[model samples]
Target: MTNVSPSGPASERSTGRRVIRILIAVLVVLALVVVCFLVWAKAVMQGERPAALEAWTDDRVSIESFDDSVVMTPIDAASDRGLVFIPGAKVDPYAYLAKLVDAVAETGTTVVITKPTLNLAFFDTRPLDTFTRHAPDVDEWFVGGHSLGGVKACMMAADEEVAGLVFFGSYCSNDVSDSDLAVLSISGSDDGLSTPDKIEGAAHLLPADATFVEIEGANHASFGDYGVQPGDGVATASDDEVRDEITDALVAFWGGSGE
Candidate 1:
C-alpha cells in the first residue's frame, strides 16, 4: 500500500488552526464593537452651568452634589416627602437643577437627581435604596424621570418604599395599572420626541386615577436646561412658563402640601 504521509492528521491540524484564527478574529471584532458602544454611551449632553448656577445660589433650597446623585433640600423647612429623579438618556444630572429648583423650594420635598450608569437610566439596575439612602430623613419617596428615565422610574415604582411615580414627557412601558401607586404623567404638548399621541396611548398603563398634565408649547427639551435637543419641537412656552407649570402640577399632585 502507498503511504499517505499521514495526511489525515496534518489536514485535521490545519483545520483546527483555521478555526482558532477565525474565533480570535471574531472575538477581536466583538471587543471593538463593545468599546465603540461604551464610548458613544459615555458621550452625554452637558447641563447649562448658568441655569444650574441659579439653583446652586438659591437660598430657598440647598443643593448638594455627590458621586452618584444631586440632592436639593429646602433650607427653611424640609418635607418628609422626597423624590428620586433620574435624568433622561445621555443628559447630565445638573441639567434638571433649574427646572426642579422651584419644586424643591415650593414643596420642601427633597429631590435626589441620580447620575445613572453610562449616562442612561436603562443601564442602571441598582435598587431604589441606591438613591433614597442619601436622604435617610425622608419618610415618603416618589420616583420620577424625564423621557426614557421615566420608564425606568416606572419599573421601580413597585418597590415597597416608593409611594408614587412622576413622568416628564415620558410614559411607562411596563403595566402598573393595577398598582395603587399615585402616578403623575406630565407631557409637553409640542414634544416631538414623546409626542402627545404617544402619551395618551400609554395612558392606560398607569393607575386608573393617575393624574395627567400637558404643558402647552413645551417641548421635550423644555423639561431640562440642556439647550435645544436634536429632534425636539420648537418650544413656544418660555423657560419660566414651563417651570411654573411643572411646579404647580407637582404641588397639586402632592395634595398642595409638601409636609
Candidate 2:
C-alpha cells in the first residue's frame, strides 16, 4: 500500500490513446499516398485521336472496344494466329491502333490491345487469357508490348500458351535463356530511354536464336502514335515509316503471313 495513487488506470488510458493516435497517423499517410498516385496517373500523355480514328474506321479490320481492351480483327478472314499487344506506361491504348492495324489487316491476325491498370502495365496483374479471351477464334498467340508494356509482356511470355515474345523499345528483366519460346526484340535506334546498349546488354536473357531488329532513326515513342514522351530522343522516322517497319518485322517473324 505504498501510495499507488490510482496511477495504473491512468497509465493504461494514456497508452491506449497513444496507440490510437499512431493508427490514425498511418491511415492519413496511406490516404495521401493513394491520392498522389491517382493524380500522377491521371496526368498522362494522351494519344492522337485523329490518327487513331483512321484505324477505327478502316474497313480492313473490325475494331471493337471493351472496358479492359480493344480487339482488332480482319474482316476478310480470321487467322489462328493472334497478337496481344500492351501499350507503354500511361500511353493510351488507342495510340497503338494505327501501328497494329497492318498486323491485323495484312496478316489477318487477331490483335488485342490491353488497357492496363492505372495506365501502367506493372500495376496490371491479369493473366494472358484476360486479353486473349476477347478473340476466342485465335489459338496460336504472340505476346508483345511497347516500352514498359514490353517489360510486362516478358513476364507473361512464360505462359505455355504464348507462342512467341515481342519487345518494342524494351527488353526482358527475367532470364528466359533456357526457354524455347521464340523472341523478337525490336528497338528504336535513337531511343533515349531504352537505348541500344541496354537492349544489347539484356540480350543474353533471351534465347540464342531470338531475332533483333533496330528501326533506323526511330525513337522510344515511335512504337505508338502518342504525341511525345519525356526523356525520349527525337524521332527522325515518320509514323508511317515506323509502322511499316514494324509490320514488315512482324510479317517476317511470322513467316510471311499469319497462316
Candidate 3:
C-alpha cells in the first residue's frame, strides 16, 4: 500500500481551481470596466447634455412660502396632485428644487419643496415627520428626493402616510416596503450613480402600479438644479428642463393613478 499525503494532490488541485476562478473573476471585472467606459463615453462625451438642459431652464421661474420646518417652494400648477420634494445630501432643499416646484405648479398641481435640517442632507426622516405635524390638512402629499433623498422617500413611503413616491438620480433599495402606494422612478442615461439596472430593480420595491422613466444622457447632478445654470458644471441637463420633465411625468402618473 502506498501512503499519499492528504494535503498533496488534493491541495494542489484545489489551488489550481482557485487560481482559475480568480482569473475568471479578473476577466469579468475587466469586461465590466470596458463596458462602463463605453457607456460613459457614449452618454457623456458625445451626448446632448448642456444644450438639452438649457432649452428647458431658460424660461423657468418659481414661488415660495415659509412653513414651520419647511420653506415650501411650490411650482405653478392647477392640479390637486400635491408633490413634496426632498433635496439630496448636503444640498439646499428650497434652493435646489425651485425649478422643480415651478414645473409641478405649471402642471396644475400643488408642489412643496422642503428645507430640511443640516442643509437637507442625509437620510433623515425628522423633516418629514415635522412637515406632517405642521401641515395636517394638505389633502394630498407625495414624497420624492435625489440620492439620499430617494432613500428618505422610501423610508417615508414605508412608514409615513404618503400618496406617492418619486426618485431622481436615486435608487430604491430592498429595504423599502411601501407596495400599496404609487411610485415613479426616474434616472438619466449617463447617470453613473444610478444605473438602469438599479433603477429597473426599484420597480419591484414599489407596488405593481409603479412607473419608471429614463432620460437619456442625463448625469447625477442634472437631476437637481445644478444642471439648470449655464456654467454650473454640476451636470449636463439644465435645471428648467430637468424639473419640467420630472414634474410632467410625476403629474401624469399621479393624476392617472386617481388617488
Candidate 4:
C-alpha cells in the first residue's frame, strides 16, 4: 500500500486561503510604499536653479567637471581648504552657489555641493567619497550642508580625516555632539524652519570648541538661491548681506585662503 496525501476540497480550500493571504500582504506593503511616496512628493520643492548666474561668476570660481553626477564642483583652486557640501532636501545643487560660491569661494576654499537623490541628503550622504579619493591636493577637508544636509554631515564629521563640520541654518542630530572635530553652526534669526531656539537646544551635541553664529535677520530660505521656502520667515537682510555674514563666520572658523 502506498501512502497518499489529502487531495480533496478541504486541501484545495486551505491552499486557496494561503494564496489569498499572500496577495493581501503584498497589497498592504505596496499601499504603504505608495503612501510614503505621496508624503515625500508633497514635501518636494519645485524651484529651478538660477543657472544664468553661473555666467556672471566670471573668474571668481571656475566650475569644474567631475565624474560624479551627484556633485557640482565649483573650485577655487588657489585655496588650500576644501568643503564637500550636501544640499538641503528638494533644493538644487547649483542653488547653494548663492551662499557658498558668493561668500566662501572667494575665501580660497573649493566647494563641492552634492546633488542628492530627489534632493534629499540622507539618500546619498557619502557621495563625497569620490572626491576624497581623487582630490589629494586639498590638505584640509570639511563636510558641510544646509538643513537636513547638515544633520547628515554630522555623521561624516566623525571621520578622523574630516577637519571640521559646518552647518547653514541647520543642526546636528546628536551624532557628533561630543566630537573633537571643529564645528561651526550658523543659523538665521528669522529662520522658521531651523529656528534659533532649536539650534540652541542642539548645542549640547557639539563639542566645547564648537562655534554657533546667528545671522541678524536672515531666513532659512536665504541659505540657498531657491525662492522662499514654504514655512520660512520673512528675511530682513538681503541675500548679499546674509551671505556675506555667513562667509565671514565660516572664514573665521576654517581659516580660509584669505587668512
Q: Model 1, residue 233: displacement in angstroms?
A: 1.6
- Where does candidate 1 stray beyond 4 Å? 1-6, 255-259
Candidate 2 similarity to native, TM-score:
0.92
1-259 per-residue lDDT for model 2 (tens digits): 5665556888899989999999999999999999999999976677899879999889889999999999999888667889899888999898999988887777778889999999999999999888988988888999989989988998888754688888989999988889888899989999999999999999999999999999999999999888878899999999999999999988888754435
How many angstroms is residue 94 displaced in model 1 relative to the true structure, after the best TM-score fit? Answer: 0.6
lDDT of each: 0.91, 0.89, 0.60, 0.75
Q: Which candidate, 2 or 3, has the higher lDDT?
A: 2
Predicted model with the maximum TM-score? 1
Cα miss at 255, model 2 (Å)? 3.7
What is the lDDT ranking, best to worst? 1, 2, 4, 3
TM-score, per-candidate, Cα-based? 0.94, 0.92, 0.62, 0.81
- Model 2's alpha-carbon lDDT is 0.89
lDDT of 4 by residue, 2-39 (tens): 99998999999999999999999999999999999868
- Candidate 4 residues lying further than 4 Å off, grouped into runs, are 1-11, 14-18, 21-25, 28-56, 65-77, 125-127, 175-177
lDDT string for model 3 (1-259, tens) is 9998679888999999999999999999999999986564333111134533443353433343464334332333344455666766555443444445444445545555566554443524475556544444456777887876787777767777777788887866645543567778888876666666667766666777677787755667777543332222235566556766776776677552223
In model 3, the runs with Cα more than 4 Å from the true position are: 1-62, 65-80, 120-129, 132-137, 174-178, 227-240, 256-259
Q: Pick the candidate with the highest lDDT.
A: 1
